[model samples]
Target: MIDTSMGLKDMSKRDILVNVAVLIGFIILCMGGGGIMGAITRNDFGDRSEWYKALIKPSFNPPNFLFGIVWPILYLLMAIAAFAVWTKTGLTKEPIPLVIFFIQLALNFIWTLIFGKAKDLLASLVEIIILWLFILLTIKKFWKVNRGAALCLAPYLAWVTLAVALNYKYWELNPNMKPDYSWFVLKTEL
Candidate 1:
């Protein structure tokens, strides 16, 4: 976009190129954030963990690969939605929507840790319910800023809703299971 009052029609080629690059950068940044966290949380590689394999899961549980596939797509959509909101209000103005977005994203990572890493069924379920609510709050806030941005989060909300149910099922199946936290506390040699 043109820096001045001129319309897009007046944007110079360099300005257009820079804008495109910046947009791409935003997408990469957002998706990369999720990719890093997802890697930290997932446990489906190399014959899978015996602990996870033994845990009773719901009949409707999805294949592990499905998670690897679905999350990236969802992250991409979230990135696009965030970019849309940023385009509307920049970073400083209309900060609530973006703040909610980050909060939800953080909660997302926390749920994975509680469920996947820590193996705390009850905690994961509770955390996910909060995450789902925050997702809804984000959608409502994004709607006030950009309808398109809000719509982009719909699938995410749906996925998290499914997750909430799945986590509940896990909790029911593993009521007495204690969370493993030996890995959670970092061990280091001084």
Candidate 2:
């Protein structure tokens, strides 16, 4: 937006550009955290065919490749929504909305670890439920700050709802799948 006579209150071109940059930066930060965590916990080659593929998935269950595409978009939307709230109440002052946002963000990563790394279907179901609630809370708080921001999270909430179904279906189908926590246990014969 080119502003010839720059009003004191009106945003100039530089302001607009700067805002875009900041928003993009916010998106990159969120995506980076999620991507890093996913990389850490993800199976080799990003294809868990040997593991997840072997399991019996429901008909509604999406192809694994779809997840690879969907998550980045969701993360971007989530970051934009959070940034909108952050603009209203920055880190300087303790903001309840931001607090909820961070909590949900942490839960997001935790869910990935539980499902992907731990391979605990039942536990993942429980954790995803908690994450969904936190996302709702964050959306409610964000709505008070910016309606568009809250709306941005709607897709995320919807996706998670679908994920809940998927998680439940997997849990129901595979009654014998348990997390292998033996890695943490020591094998001392003594």
Candidate 2: stretches off by over 4 Å: 1-25, 44-46, 182-190
Q: What are the per-residue Cα lDDT tens digits for candidate 1 across 1-190?
A: 2242457679888877766775786677668877776678656221376767777889988887788788888988888888777777666866888888889988987777777788888888889999999999999999998898899999999999988988899889878888987768989999
Clash pairs (backbone) in predicted model 2: none
Candidate 2 lDDT, 1-190, residue by residue in tens: 1232455468766766766776787787779888987787677223653668667889998877888898899999988887777666665654898788889989998888788777889988999999999999999989997799999999999999999999999899999887865533679986
Provide the TM-score for each candidate, comma-separated.
0.87, 0.82
Using TM-score as the measure, which candidate wins?
Answer: 1
TM-score of 2: 0.82
Q: Superposing all C-alpha atoms, what RMSD in Å does each candidate have to the true structure?
A: 2.8, 4.7
Model 2 C-alpha RMSD vs. true structure (Å) is 4.7
Report the poorest 10 consecutive residues by lDDT, candidate 2: 1-10
The per-model lDDT (C-alpha) reads 0.81, 0.81
The 10-residue segment of model 1 with minimum total lDDT is 41-50
**In model 2, what lDDT does residue 125 have?**
97
